[model samples]
Target: MDSNGVDEQEMKLVQGAAGYVLEDVPHLSDYILDLPTYPNPLQSNPAYSVVRQYFVDEDDTVPQKIVVHKDSPRGTHFRRAGPRQKVYFKPADVRACIVTCGGLCPGLNTVIREIVCGLHYMYGVTEVLGVNCGFSGFYSKNTVTLTPKDVSDIHKRGGTMLGTSRGGHDTSKIVDNIQDREINQVYIIGGDGTQKGASAIYKEIRRRGLKVAVAGIPKTIDNDIPVIDKSFGFDTAVEEAQRAINAAHVEATSVENGIGLVKLMGRYSGFIAMYATLASRDVDCCLIPESPFYLEGKGGLYEFIAKRLRENGHMVIVVAEGAGQDLVAESIEQQDASGNKLLKDVGLWMSLKIKEHFAKQRKMDITLKYIGTFCPLPNFNSSYLRFLKYECDWVHVSDPTYMIRAIPANASDNVYSTLLAQSAVHGAMAGYTGFISGLVNGRHTYIPFNRITEKQNKVVITDRMWARMLSSTNQPSFMNPPNGATEGAN
Candidate 1:
């Protein structure tokens, strides 16, 4: 029952020169027999009275790739996200519930708040419930009613007010809870694994012939979710990451031969590390999961570090958590509640290896300090420890791992969070089931759950962004020609 395979409703593929281009997501009407429709309450709302053409046409779709040649087909296009003139449920009959699963990220509270407010103010629908602790909350009897007053200023906070957890996903129990509670609209928020769970729930609900609308707002601090311009909180993560990079830069430049190493969160893709390093432009070397590098060689990371230090007398290195995992000896592999593979401490491993390389060189004494972060351990120093391990006595560091995600969403992310939440609510109200509220090429659209979960969006090492990062840091490509983008995610 995995959504990894395409269903007939999702076979809206267009044949172009590239061939087999997925163009649209599944609709509830495709599976549910004789679904009812009602006029959208927004048509009578005074808030939209001043607006022209507030409703998006069903035929409207956003292209996945905009920079294509004239002769090329439109390529992939997703159903645009917005309120429809016709909705599936009346305000009185709609009883909606929201659940947040997986890890914490900035703007979670904002999405929750906006969903409550959007349903209340825009559609005149009340009675929103917050599912206590993720998918398990459904059967655990963990529930709380949500109102505009309840989530009044939650947008100014970090993490989720509804609470979240990894794993604990039982499809039957969850859908049964939905059935028992008579919840017609279920809003599930989380990353890829959580989306997969959402997809499963949607399939089960459809199989049971329920009139539920399952809408997902893709949540990942990594920005690894595909079919979207970027995930929510990514801007805030990159912006907040500047603090640590600045700290590392100042620390590295303060003393002679001082090396400041920073470890960032990126389990499968190095988007965070790559974007942070690119924004700072203060890093001497950047390492990520997308581009693998060996420790010792004529043109290896060790030689690059030695040359950079010799040229500048001080340097800062940024490494993603999943970067160089193969290089770490006996790195224990594990999985979390959501089935995400646990990553070894690449920050610690890299720091020690770099120190050892310098030690064996016997050329110059280096003052190196570091920090790292882990996903499960949200405590203050857990992420810092990723940069500096216990094996080295020279570990001095700063931890912004939790600090970044725990802070209130900045202006940019706050706005983005509002759009994503409202879009999900609109889609659910419009009867779009098993779809994710995501951005495709800057336009908001409803993407199929399977389209986003099948593969993670990784950093393309051969692309211009990687080249720009290399140009910014003056770091070597690390590979003779670098590896393909499919060398696994991030």
Candidate 2:
């Protein structure tokens, strides 16, 4: 106390008997303590680690600028919140299970192995079960309990060892089973369809007061899952595509007189084809489902190949399997072995077109090699199994014991899959459910839980602008047109 019954100084420091000092200050510019001296541990919480890592710079400063080119209008609807609510789940109390649904992808085993290992080893979770045949496996008696030892050798295997089914599980029944088994956490690994099922299961479980946490692991060769940057098998699929393209290149180069047409798999999107084209520079042209090519059009694939043969001596064309050649065949009124009008095979048709164009216009001799059997090994069954059943007269086994089992683990997908599995487990332990762990821009990240809202999922592309951008023909618009149209113009 001062003589005037008030502290004279703007800041007052009181010392205690144990050498502890309390500093009291109000609007004192000179004596104000900096934020560095008073750190908030919540700011560094690991749950928001992924978000912070992306938004914060190397110097721990938040970036001032963020550029979002696409979905700007939809993005504007989102309002930034002050801080994320902390939700925690007891690691021991959480009983988790993983189920792989749909067809097998390259990294399914990798993800399965990681989930099993991460739960048991890192989080001290031992009651992790592997549901076989996806949703069906949950209700059926075929549910397999997984241990760390069971998953130890499965990193490199191509398919899910726990098995998968398309869409057989009754959501209510599955919830009942989960409750009966006392499963508190369920990790569903598959595509959008599977996620929809997972969401249903989540709703059912929550409704029943089981307190089960349901999360999804995005697994699809299509790479169409929203919010996630890239799924696990996408890289493997691209790698396989590159290998096929490189092999095709070798064959084309060795023949010296032939053009190789290789077809890739992608139904609605050209992500795989585009990524493969970027990976395998040897691919001369890439045709995707997003891009439709016409035989009569100027700079069409046929004309492009013909020009390539006339100019570069040989060419390799990569076509998406879904890019129907029916348009071209319909234009020409061609029919096939079934007495039904047949669309030309993309590879064979393009090859024939190239040959016919060269032979008619110029007296150039050209050989065509249509390499269409380049199926990736792991996904080959899923890609062609139905065809094999009908075309090859293969009998369907009613109780196919071997087909019901999961794939052996592969070495390539094991590491990343395990890392992702652990990340998901960590997130779950920290009260993050209904979110998937994703690797984006070459870094491990969590797809925000809120981003998977019903509105986001229900959002559809009414306009074809984004779809057109994915097309091969439209992509060239980004580059300045050549002065003379590259000599292939009609």
Candidate 3:
């Protein structure tokens, strides 16, 4: 404590800039002394000559938190990502390689394309290699030279043009290969675990006194990687889920006392499930990893389903794959190659539970009957087939094998991936190492690798965004008793 007991630490002032701290990224100059710089190609390129603001000032930064109080310190900031006036590596000296690790995401191809194009078009760098099948490819010699023409139409396709894998990170071998191939700039695209691997590679490179610049393009369809606003391909995953949600809605409404149960990919964070449920107004209940839900108790999912179905003819239930793990009985513990927990099929379990509960209770006597619209076919006799009334007390909708992460990036994700890729390319060219190209508070910035991979970001069940989603779905938070509304539910 200071003498005055003013608690100056609460102010959290930065050096020379009161209350503002720059979370600066590592540069080659930080480790390698007297690193020479070359003029940025954009300075003389006719394509960018007419643009007024072609270069980003070194002093420019973006705040991590935008909703701070008036009296609060400005909090932390990161260097804004873009082209700089001078770059550490010359065009002819740049030997870059791109690798995608972990699982497949929507915009992997888009990111690969932009990174190659950004280097080829923005700078005159010629040598770019695609490390196939992830980190293992580093030693496996599964590489192909990448050019703008090679990735020209790959963006229009689904999945990565360069294949990806999980848990092949051999730091010694990878760095050895990098040194062997004279690769100076490395672009790694992956999720939290993958970024951790990227961090390891960077540390090894730094330890060996190598001049390679390692840049990370964070990739997680789950949106669990912290510090970034949102990862690329998350939008496309959520959008692709709309089709499944719509299909469930149709099936549920079609059957008597129907319960369309859908499961989405969310092993840790519930962003995909939450947003999909919110977008799907048909959902009557949302279950996620962040929100603990019961099934057999007073405030259980069964009670909510009974109530919702009683009020409405049918109900749709959206659950993240990681939800209800505590309730599901799994005797064996398993982990994937990337060390992520293997989640059981919560959607199937939920469907079975709902069916058993309803069948045992025998409380519902649904005789759903609907008439099809009569229409006259061109050059054919008018005919209409009416759906017969069915008496199924309970039904379910499930297709757990359909995964959304492998699909092509939607328009929103494509643009976001392009920006992220360009930002990574820029940071690499500018000599930033051991950093992630991510969006913080809507502004793209360079984040240290450890800051991104140290922990996973999760959904805040108590936050207002969750409340908004709850309000949209009209679903119970599954937090309160059946006789009362959920506590603190918005």
Candidate 4:
């Protein structure tokens, strides 16, 4: 205590601390009351009066600011949503735009409908435009004005009405288009690359002293976006993948000692393959990019498949495209339009190797039937197996790639996509920018776009989920042993 019986540090203001200057934040009473109101009776609900809190910190001392610096030992850097009841722009004056980029996922149309409906019915924003062909539409003058009525039935559809593409990372052009249209908010729907572009666009808007709010809905069939618990369409993808696995199972069992090798769509992570295998429980062996597998060792995949075939007379293998990239002789570093690495045809390689192994070893006169390649390999059939019930050898390969990605969202995904779109619209209207609406631990939340694009959400091999998958398939756990050893050794 000081000599005057008071501490001097208590009187001085602590800037950027938790709960500092929160009273200075503008309130709904200051501006929202002056703006025009909507005719919707949903606004009369008692819950409308209760504003939802954004920051998880219960400390009342934190300030209400767009960005806060947390240099203290106990504080964390966080982005918080503004008061739900108030928004930065007036409803009638706001011009909102929606765009979809990156590859297609199941619930893209559903999200578009939800955003348009939310803006029209809840917020009374009448002017909404849709940008076509991804970010290129901004510069290319390809936009269509949208309405709630126009998007009413979009949720029942599959792909995005706005259409989508991969590249077009020019932030300046996008901002120029936004400013020309006097856009107040932007909703970007796609995966990590799309959100990263959104972040850049928002930064450019801020640099130009504009008040446009940018929001994103996380979309990736691969489910590889960082920090998100789940992405839209993943459930539907898994469900569709089950059908493909069943087909492979039927094909494998139809012939004697047949092996079914099914390749699912997953470039970086094996979430789709892993989840599909888990859901179906029909795959005898599941390989993902996260878990590498050897081909010729005693405990490797070759022996594993042979053992499964010997015991059950039929075997099914589920492999993500990215699982055995390292096994290929050449580099598969080429990326597609969305910057995804072109997989080195691990499925084809595995099928050929399995056939070669069985042929060279001649352990048994097994026939292999490979399907789903762009073209069948050059007339590589065996004479001994020609007279069998099936003309081919031990295995059949199929890739359920586009079939899964193009389907509509399932019941769970529809709910998830609706809430995600609603949350995205709420964030955009509340003046929250540079964030993606994401499900964090099953809670509807907005995560920073930069963080979402920071890293990929890969399956942790040490987690219990991996253990469950291993137990389900009974595949070899460690593909690469300790030390500097490589995979695919005899």
- Clash tally, candidates in order: 7, 11, 0, 12
- Candidate order by lDDT, decreasing, is 1, 3, 4, 2
Candidate 1 lDDT over 316-356, as tens digits, reads 99988888776665534678887778776667666666777
TM-score, structure 2 vs. true: 0.65
Write down the RMSD of all candidates, one decimal each.
4.9, 15.3, 9.4, 8.5
Predicted candidate 4 versus true structure: per-residue lDDT over 1-490, tens digit per residue: 4242122211223345443332121112221235433333224445455745432332222211223356524232223332254456678888999999988889989899988987887777899999999999999989999998899888787888888898987889889989998988899998888887887786666556576777888899999987667899999999989988888888888878888878888888999999999998888988899887677566777778788889889888888878877776564257778677766767666776777678788886554544354433223345423422243343323347767888788889998888898878776766666667777555566565656777999999999999999999887796565443345412
Off by over 4 Å in 4: 1-42, 45-83, 367-398, 480-490
Q: Give TM-scores for every candidate, taking all chains together and pairing residue i with residue i.
A: 0.91, 0.65, 0.89, 0.81
Candidate 3 accuracy as TM-score: 0.89
Error of 4 at 174 (Å): 0.9
Model 3, poorest ten-residue lDDT window? 368-377
State which candidate has the highest TM-score: 1
**Residue ranges of candidate 1 with Cα displaced over 4 Å:** 1-6, 12-22, 372-398, 481-490
C-alpha lDDT of residue 170 in model 1: 93
lDDT tens readout by residue for model 3, 1-490: 4342222212323344558787777777766889899999989888899999978899888998898887888778888999998999999999999999988889999999999999999998999999999999999989999999999989888889889889988999999999999999999999989988988898778777789999999999999999989999888888888877787788778867766767788888899988887777777778889988767667677777788788888987788878878776444677889998877666644554565567678888433211111221122222211111122222332342245787789999999999999999899989888889999989889888777877889999889989998888776677754543222101
Model 4 lDDT-worst window of ten? 23-32
